[model samples]
Every structure is written in C-alpha cells, then in structure tokens.
Target chain A: MTFVNVGTLGTQPGQREAVVAILTRANPQLAQAGCLLYEVGTSEESPDTVFVTELWTSAEAHQESLQLPSVREAIAEAMPLLNGQMSGFQYQISGSPLRD
Target chain B: MTFVNVGTLGTQPGQREAVVAILTRANPQLAQAGCLLYEVGTSEESPDTVFVTELWTSAEAHQESLQLPSVREAIAEAMPLLNGQMSGFQYQISGSPLRD
Candidate 1:
C-alpha cells in the first residue's frame, strides 16, 4: 500500500508562509526520491497553521527520502519557525485519484 | 489556489474499512463535481481512524459539492458509523505535485 502522511505544523503568528515556502522549495528534491504527491498549504481556519500532505510509493521510500540532504536541510530550516505544536497521522492509502 | 481538506474521522473498532468503502464508492461523483483529488485512507498508527484528503478547484466548488444529492447521501450514510470524534482543517493549496 502507498504511504500517506497528513500533518499540521503550528507556527508563530505570521510565520506560516515562511515555513510553507521552505517546504514548497524542497518539493522537487522530494519528488525525485519517490514522492508521488508532496503538497503544502496554509490553513484557512487557522492563520498560524500549515498543512503538509504527502503520498509516497511506500513507507520505506518515505523513510529513505528523509535521509536525503535536501530534506534534512529543509527540516532544519523549518524547525525554528515552528511554534512547538504539531500533530500528524500516518495512513496506508487504499484508494486515490492517481489510481484512476 | 485550490482548496485542500485534511481530516481524520474516528470510527468504531473495525468499522474503518466500511467507512472507506463508502467514501471510495462516492469518489467518481465527487470528481465530477470538480474534486481534483479525493483520497481515503486508514491510519497505520490508529486502527479506528480514517483519513480523508481532498483537493478542489476552489472553496466554492467544495461548498457546492456538499449540496449535491449524492454527497449528502454519502454523508448521511457515513454519519452513523462515525464515533462522533472528528477533526479537520481547511487550507489553501499554493503548491502541489500536479503543478509540476
């Protein structure tokens, strides 16, 4: 099954866009490493929150991508903007638009 | 910008698959209503939680979809199976794999 990750990162007020920019710039590198979908956005209901949704070929692929230098650097850059409140859940995708 | 919804629905033990099935069956109709991406998944870390990730052409498109008879029926059908614990956030997608 494909691996799915959906998470929310809470940032300091007005820092949401910065965190999103860092993640968005890292997408090309992420896609090169088996990321099927890498989407980043800011919450409409919460001005200080950013949402990250990802789909990978497999859990192993996602784990391996984390080891890539680009991803590690992006994480390091985003850490400071984060407000220390984040939550996420991992899922096994059974169906998706890509399948059709 | 597209509208993105990332949410988790908690179901009764062993009812996750049933909820997924219903949502999966509803996808074609959703797509016809401007749903760019509609995926349903089961959490790897939580057996009774289901994740729904969606992308729509716009927030208005999503709102209109909810008024569709088919969508309303699906929601009505899924409500009974829900454990009444659900949380979600809406976002404005600025970047996605589909863009590239």
Candidate 2:
C-alpha cells in the first residue's frame, strides 16, 4: 500500500522566511529521492501554521527519507524557527480519499 | 502518478459523536468505491480537531466520491456539527513523501 504523511510546521514569529528557506533548500534533495510528492504551503486560515503533505511509494521509502543528510540538516536548521508543536500521521491508501 | 487530497473536518462543540457517526456511516460506502484508502481519526494533541488524510488512485476518483449519494448526504448531515473552517489541498504523489 502507498503511504502518506500529514503534518504541520509551526513557525515562530517573524521566522516564516527562514522556515520556507529551509524547505526550499531541502525540496530538491527530497524530490530526487523516492518521495513522490514533498510540498510545504501556508495554511489559509492560520498564517503561522504551515501544512506539509507527502505521498511515498512505500512505507520503507518514507522511512529512508528521514536519514538523508540534507533532509536532517535542513530540518534541524529550521527547528529554532518553529513556535508550536509539529505532528503527523501515517496512512495506507485505501481508495479515493476525497469527496469531490 | 497518484492523487491525494488532504483536509480536515471541524466539528462543533459536543458534536464529535455526530461527526464520527457521520463518517462511520459513510465509510463503508466510500470503501465500496474506487477509494484505495479511507479512514478517519482524532488528533493526538487536540481532541476537538479531526484529521483526514486520503490517497486516491486519481483525481477523478476523488471527484467521484463527492457525488456518491450516501457520501454527500452524510457530509451535509454533519455540516451543522462543524465549529471551525475545514480546508484541504490536492497533491500528486511525487516520491516517498516522508522522512524516516
């Protein structure tokens, strides 16, 4: 089954740019891997909160991405920029997961 | 290669049961469709917030689910039970969409 991870990035005040920068620098490396989609965007309702959504070919692939040197470094660099808690869940694609 | 829709369901106070009830009622019907993975769960930190994550075989499948008579009816029935705005985004599974 395909795996997906849904999470949020809580950026500290005035640190949005740095967080995005970290993502920008990290995306290409992530894209080069087994990651099918690795994207980060701002929440429409909450500017301080960022939405991160991903789809991986397999659960193993998802686990491997965490070890990427660049991925870890970039995220570590952005850690100080965060304000609130970042959380996520893993799922096995079942069917059409949307309504419309 | 695959399409994913990430969104949330905002249930009004004391209406969590109504929302889950709605989803519980609609899931079997959703599973009968082209949906590959369809499930709902509560957030670990915020009991009031619900997180929905789905991976559809295609965007078309995602759209079709909306038209399902039961699906539509269920979501509509649960509308009044919502407290905050529910929003989502669509993505093409790019790679392994996660870190280890």
Candidate 3:
C-alpha cells in the first residue's frame, strides 16, 4: 500500500499567484521523484487558499524524494510565501471516493 | 486557513487492532467536527502501518460535521475493515514540522 501526501496551504490573502508559481515550478521535481500525481489548485470560493495533493509509491519513497536537493530548494522557496503552520498527513487510502 | 485533514491507514497485516477500534471510536465524531487535534497513531518501525492525524476547522466546518447521523454510522462501520483507494487532501497549514 502506497501513501498519498495531502496538504492544504493558506497563503497571505492576496499572495495566491506567488504561491502557485512556486508550486507549479516545483511539480516537475516531484514528478521526477516518483510522484504519481501532483497538483496545486485554488479554491473558487476561497481565493486565499491553495490545495496540494500528491500521490507517492510509499512512505519511504516519498521520504527519499523529499531528500532531493531540488525538493528542498523548492520548499524553501515556498516557505516565505506561506502564512501559517503547514499541516498534513501521509495516508494509505482507506476508501476510494472515485465513482468510476 | 483552518483545514487539516491528513490521513494514512493501511491495514490487513494484523488489522492494527481493529483499525484502532475504528479510529478510537471515530474520535468523538471528529471532536464534534470542530476537531483541533485527533490522533490514532502507532508506527514503531511500521507495525501494519497505521497513522491517522487530523485537525479540522474550516471546509464548511468539516462539511458540517459530516452531516451528523453519528458520523454516517461510524463511516459505515469502517467500511468493512477497509482495504484501499482512499486518498486524502484538504490543507491550510503550510509549514510547521514542529521541533519543540
């Protein structure tokens, strides 16, 4: 059972664009690190919010990916644009919300 | 920002004590759907691999506490002990890998 790392980001009210830029630029690095899917999206109702969803092969694989210099650098770059504490979880997918 | 729903649960090796007793009895319906911190943890070198962490606030008040009904009958009785395909996201926290 692989792990999916899900995260939600809250930016500085109007700093959504900067956040998106950071995330978009960082996606390739994640992909190269065996990320099954990586996306950073904005909410229609909440303009200041950003959502990050990722699927990785395993916890160890995800950790190995994070150890890459590019991942570290990208995260460092994103750190400033963020506002509050980063909270997240790496889950094993208990149920599929998909209907297809 | 108020959104933190990170989950990682993989069972069936040893059932992880009945999935931690259905996540400790569903953690008070996710602490009245206003959960600040809910934890069901155990990973000393990965024992059947179960780790679920939550801290919810926004997201329409966690979807209005999942529309009650006893949290959908404790998630339909743990969806028959779960297996796979449940990916999760929903984050507002950006970076707080607490070190204190």
lDDT of each: 0.82, 0.65, 0.62
Model 3 global lDDT (CA atoms, 0 to 1): 0.62
TM-scores of the models, in the given order?
A: 0.90, 0.54, 0.50
lDDT of 2 by residue, A16-100 (tens): 6567656755355565666776656554455666667766777788888889898888778888889867765665543333332
Best by DockQ: 1
> Mind giving the per-residue lDDT tens digits that candidate 1 earns over A53-97?
888888889999989888898889999999999998788877863
DockQ of 3: 0.07
- Per-prediction DockQ comes to 0.51, 0.13, 0.07
lDDT by residue (tens digit), candidate 3, B1-100:
5565656666667777677666566345556567765445554555665666455667677778777887677667665666764544555644221111
lDDT of 3 by residue, A10-72 (tens): 788688878877666634556666676554656566677777756666677788987888778
In terms of TM-score, the best-performing candidate is: 1
* Residues B1-100 of candidate 2: C-alpha lDDT, one tens digit per residue: 4566677766787776557656655356665666665555554444555556766777788888899888788778888888867766555543332332
Q: What is the C-alpha RMSD of each candidate to the true structure, in Å?
A: 2.2, 7.4, 10.4
**Ranking of models by TM-score:** 1, 2, 3
Cα error of candidate 3 at position A59, Å: 0.8
| Model 1 spans with C-alpha error above 4 angstroms | A96-100, B96-100
